[model samples]
Each structure stands twice: as C-alpha cells, then as structure tokens.
Target: MSLLPDSAVTSAPGLRRAQLLLARQALEAILAAQRPADAILQDLFRDNRQCGSRDRARISELVYGVLRDLRRLQAIAGVQADAGALCALRLLDQGLADAATLEAWGLTASTALARRLAGFDPATLTPAQRDNLPQACHERLVAQYGEDATAALAQALRGQAQVDLRVNRLKATREAARQRLAQEGVKAEPTPRSPLGLRLSARAPLQNLASFREGWVEPQDEGSQLIALLVGARPGDTVVDYCAGAGGKTLALAAQMQDRGELLACDISAARLKKLRPRLQRAGVNSVVGLALPDETALAKFAGRCDAVLVDAPCSATGTWRRNPELRLREPDFAALQALQLRILGDAARLPRAGGRLVYATCSLMAVENDEVVRAFLEQHPEYVREDAGEILRAAGADWQEPELRLLPQRHGTDGFYAVAFRRQGE
Candidate 1:
C-alpha cells in the first residue's frame, strides 16, 4: 500500500505543478547529497507512494532533463539558476513551455534567458561548451580522438539513448523475441552490431510485457551486449565475471555456455550481487555461482582456474553519459580510481589459468582509464601477452576490425566502450 500523491490533483495544470515541485525537491536533494540519483528517486517515490505512473514519469523526466543539460541551462539562465530556473529553461528550450508558463513554473523572467537561447545554434559555442562536456575530460578526448570526434561524441552522448534489449538465447531467439514484441504492438529492430540485440524505437512499459516478464528479453545496451558476446564463454568452461554488478553479463554468459559451465559472478558488494539473484532466476540461469570477495576462502576456491575472466573494472562511466548524465555532477578521484583498477586487475588476472583469456573492459571514453590502465598492467606482468581484441570479435563474426575494441557512441551508435584482451602464454 503506497501513499504517494496520486494524479487527482485538481486539474491538468495543477498536476503539472505538483510534479514539477516534486522534481525540484528531488533535484536539490540529489545535487546536495552524495547518494546516487536512482537511490534518491527510489526513496522519494517510496515516501510518496500514491504518486501515479504519469506523475512519476513526469517528475523523473524533469529531474533527469535538468541533470543532463545542467551546465547549458545554468549558462542560459545565468549563475542564479536554481531548479525552477533550470526547469523553465529546459521546458522552454523543448517548446513545452512559454514565458508565461515559465513564470507559472516559478522562474523569474529575464530578457537574457530568452535572448541567449533564441535561435540557439550548437556550432556557435566552443566544442566543450556545445557538447556540455567537462573541459578537462574534453581536452583528453581531443588529445586522443582529436577535436572533431570528441565534439561528435559529446553531441551524441547528449541525446536520449535508444532502448536496446538482449534476446535471451536460453529462452528465446532474436527472431522469436522480435515477433513477440511485434505481436504486442511494439516496434523493434535488430541492432546493427550485436546479433542478439534489439532496438526499440519508442518507450514501452516493458515490465508489463509477457516476453520481458518471462525472461525472453532483458534490457541491455548494444555495447553491453557486445561485451557479453566478447567474453566468448563456452560450455563446460570455467568463467569468471569479475566485478559483476547486478550480473547483466553474468546472465548473458550463462546462456552463452548453455548453462553447462562453472560461472562465478564475483563482486565486492554483496548488496549489488543480491539484486542479481531474482534476475538470474527470471532468466532461468542456474550455472552462475555468486562469490563475494576479498573473502580469502572464495578467492582461493577460484584462483588460477578460470578459462576466461572478464575484468569489467569500475570506471568513470563516461560512456554511459547518454542515459546517466548525473555522472557529470561529481568528479571521481581519477588517481584513486586508477589505483583501484590496477589492484582489481592484478586480483582478477589471478583467476585465469595459464593460456586462458583475460578480457579487460570498461564503459569509459577516457584514455587514462582505458588504454593507460592496460598499458600499465602489461608492463607489470611480462608473462601475459596482449591478444588482438578486434580479431577475437571478428572471429565471433562482429564487424569490428581495429587492433583493439573501442566503440564510440558517435560512430558505433552504442555507448563508448573500451576492451582489450590478454592471454597468459603457457601452451
């Protein structure tokens, strides 16, 4: 029984105002607090259990819309931009609100706000400003990908990400899943890069769909689907999904193995892993053995035994900015994150046996966390040799053909992902 305010708020206009007020409260709390955006929303909705679906969606959109375009809205509205001002700028920019409506939303009217955004052109602003990217990170991208591509990525990431899903091969084929969605009056198309990936053109209440509830499909980005495919786990093989948060790739790998392999999903946080349990059951996956580590017993149980180990190491999550712009609000300590990546890499490498594969992956666009980490790891461990990541993908029939696997959001229509593989040569 939820007590969240329902949509019965007087009239349509009043409903909008109520939702906007909720959004403002949520935004302020999210910005000031260190907790993740999703957690804040969960708590907010839990307390306001009577908030209807429409109210929830509207409130969420306002919160995310402002967070995504936070910098641009602040610039347009000047330094005095609060949630009201930011919301007004966004609504006006999207043509959802006029000056009067902006005032109605509790934003003070200013000629500067109107003038700055009138007939706005992205090309007029500098690349970083235009793309709304952090300047230091933008500079790093410029150094690696050059100015043009970096700008393109920023623009691409600023757009709303398309909904992508992985057709669970264990329960349904891609063709069958597509047919099911079509039967339900949902439009979907196969993703370009991943054979198992489906792209949804419009948002649908997926949880209500029989296909999703039956685990015929699981929502996953094409980039993430590709990473799971790249793991290349086979039946009867011992595989490790190191740092498996929520076990998205774990479920995919279990299906890849036809549920016949020893698949250990390892993570430092048991709570995150706990959430993976029901999803695994829904997907009918039975092969994955969850192991929370730095537990010496668990580490010893799997040490030097895995045929393939996926070090999906923690990162800045720069690649996922399209869906999660809240990342831009805070700066993670790169030095500390890098040190942790190194330690995790060393620990994960210990799980792969001689001649086994080590696939290091991150959903990050930064060269510091992507290539630099791999470079440092290789220098420290001479026994391990770099494997041709692109060739491995090609062998699996992916169209990627570079020396390493670096999929850019702008070019690949997928989140920016970096993956490099290594093999311990003993065979």
Candidate 2:
C-alpha cells in the first residue's frame, strides 16, 4: 500500500525511525491477536533495552491510540491502513501534529490522503465503524441502549480511564491515604460515588508509592468499589466472595467486616488464589480465608450458611473497554458466557442462607452478560428475590436511582459495571 507520496518518503534519521518502528511493531502484534496491547508493549520494551521512558511513552501512546480508534482510523486511511499511515492519520486527527511534521516522526502519507484525513466525515462510515467497535458489540449495545446512547458510550470508552484507588480501610482512612499519596507526589481527589475511593488526575507509578507498598490503598475502579459496597458485608457477618480472582473485592469485603467475620475467597485457580496472600497481609486483614474450589460444585460445602454471597461472575468485560480497548475489536460468544454466568450465580446462590443477601455483578455493558444472566438465575431459583440495588447503595452513602447498579463510563466517570442485589426468602 502506497500511503506516502514520493516527496514524503525521505530517509528520516535514526531515533525517529526507531520510535515509529517500535510503535508499528506493537500495533501489529496487538492486531494479530497474539496478546493484549499492554503486554505486547511490555515485551517490546524489554527486548529493546535502549528505549528510554520517553520513547516507551511515545510508542505506547501511538499503539493505544490506534487500537482505541482502529475502525475510525481505518475508515480515514482507506485501503492503505499500514502502521505508518494510520499513526500519521491518528496524530493529525488528534491535532497533535500537522502534515508537514509527519515526516519528522518517520510517518508519511500522500497529500491526497492527508487532505482526506483532514476533512474526514463520520457520515461516510457505518455506525459500527463510526463508533470504532466490532459489529456485534455495536449491535448489542445499540439494541440495549439505542443508537445515540450507544454512540455516546462508545465515545466515552475511546478516551483514557482515570487511575482510581480504593483506600484499604483496615490500614488507614481515605483522608489519611490521600495525605500519604500526596507526600509521594501523587495528586488525588475523592471520587464522586465511592465513599472510600480516590481518583487520580493522571497516571502515576502507584506501585512505587510508599502508601501503595504499605497496603494503604489498592488500585481499583470507583465502580468496582461501589460493587463491593453493594454487598453490604457488615462486621461479624459471614461473607463469601464466590468468584474472587485476584481478591480485590475479597479484601474490600474483609475491611467492611472490620477483620471480624469469616470471609471466604473462592476461585477455581489456585495460582490466582496464591497472589492474594501477600495482599491480605499487606492490608492487615485477618478475616479472609482463601479457598481454591475445584469447580462451582465445590461451593456446596458452604451451602445455606453465609450471610452474604457475592457472585462477581466473569463475562466479556465490555465495561472495561476504556482500559482494554482490544475488547471492542473482538467478539465473544455471548450465549456461552451467559450460560456460564447463570451457572455460577445459581451455584453461589445456594451459599446464602435464608434472608441472606446475594449480589451478582459483572464488568460488562451487554445485557446478555448482566441483566439477562440475573434474570435467568432468578427464574430458576424461586427463593431468591431481586432487591433494589440503588436503595442499598444509597444507604451506604452512594446515591443511585436505578433498581440495579448500572455504572456507565459516559455517566459515572468510571469503568462500566452492572450489579444487582438479591434476598433469599423462607427458612
């Protein structure tokens, strides 16, 4: 593909070409579906030890920018969707650079191509292309939220996500954690929704901060914090995080229990359970008991015992598109995912005793993964009745109007999340 005119194809010097080459390599690897964009970039940086922080930053910016706006960039760049042209088009489209400066970055595009990009019209592309989402994703979102709202949601996800942290209440109060982060040169403000959450204005090396290393805070989205809150696991209550992958919610629930009650963190992977050991110690939590279940059937041991059971079932993770844009490019089997979600929710529901709270949640925007799964599980389990999630969240200091907790990026300034609280009936 001839994206560059003869005049624009000059030999750019060493550093510029190297940056462009690295960016292209990362983008190609991501598009090839080998691994996540972030992982690919990590490998690239590790292999090229000479790349400084600034070089890594530039390469990452280009790679993510292209992924976030792949379909739109493809529409603008036409058939010549090579890495150089797409990067050049993305830069120009973002007003980051002009056509004249493109050659300096070792990105070249023909004058006509540049002109077409400058006057690119969204009307010329299909709705899916305009939204830069896969056709199936766009259709599902549109079916649920209508066209205009889906467009807004898609656009919201195209931007970068803020770095939010959940202050580990066992270690320190939110205010104390904020003060500690400030001392480490990281600025943060309280999130609008989550009472114990802090939102960073920009990305920071949080792992290096003394507060983070001391377990004063954990990197969690504000929406995720709210999900934990919805569980309403109080002191001395037996709570179970039924699908604790890395134990993020398990730690939060443990803190809510004030290190008093029995908090069981269950997952199918022992490897993932192992990762939570140090985090539990760092947060000074003592109530959590990490359990690796052989499968969903293993939950039978806790049947009709716990006061609260949280099923954070895995799905397509569509709500995390802002952080993982590649999700928008790939299509997941919604039917299969919904089946798995229902199976897990049903298995977990048995753990909650009569009148106990059972909460189901997912980091997904699709109804099949969220509302549909909840509806299916409730239909099969007559003892469980859906409760108003908004009421629970409101009582916990976060005001939500809907019956369920639907945290959207376009509205909530956090990652997408859907949660519904249920109550078991009868003895």
lDDT for position 390 in model 2:
84
Model 1 TM-score, all chains together: 0.91
Q: What digit string (tens of lDDT, one per residue) describes model 2 on residues 216-265?
A: 99999999999999999999998999899999999899988989988999
Candidate 1, 163-270: lDDT as tens digits: 999989899989999999999888999998788889998999998999999999999988888787787889999999998998889988898899997999999899
Task: Give the runs in model 2 whose Cα sits over 4 Å from its true position.
Answer: 1-15, 95-120, 295-298
Among all windows of 10 consecutive residues in model 1, the one with the lowest summed lDDT is 1-10
Model 1 has an lDDT value of: 0.82
Best by TM-score: 1
